[model samples]
Target: ESPNDHINSHSINNSINVISDDDVAMEDVIDADDSAAKHEQIIVKWICQRCTLVNSEHSDRCDVCSSPR
Candidate 1:
């Protein structure tokens, strides 16, 4: 190949590598966000005053005693 063609191909390869690296980084960020979301969900439980049972945020009443949250 000509020198100019070799140089152009090298630069194209470098660009492709940069793009792939960016995609991987973006996926890492997305995975981190999902993990944070799952942690938040896990931490969103409320303690039942009547029964002292740990209930999820989606529950309006105590799971064990039916006490209002």
Candidate 2:
């Protein structure tokens, strides 16, 4: 196999590995709402009451779901 072919097969093997470290990490990752209560770093962010998506204090609407603040 050419050098390029070896690299392609290695990448394909890595992609096909379901139990890869990256896949495990992605599965363990917590979403915004899940960590929102734990990570209260942003005290000034305007939390949209409608969608609960956080936005800048200056914003008049939610940045994620686009609900009016």
Which has the greatest lDDT?
Answer: 1
Question: Candidate 2, residues 1-69: lDDT per residue as tens digits?
Answer: 677856533244222111123112111232343333332122345566777655666787778887876
TM-score of each: 0.39, 0.34
The TM-score leader among the candidates is 1
Candidate 1 lDDT: 0.48
Candidate 1 lDDT at 61 equals 83
Q: What is candidate 1's TM-score against the reference?
A: 0.39
lDDT, candidate 1, 1-69, per-residue tens: 677865533244212111122112111221332333321111356777777676767889888899988
Whole-model Cα lDDT of every candidate shown, in order: 0.48, 0.46
Q: What ranges in model 1 sit over 4 Å off? A: 1-42
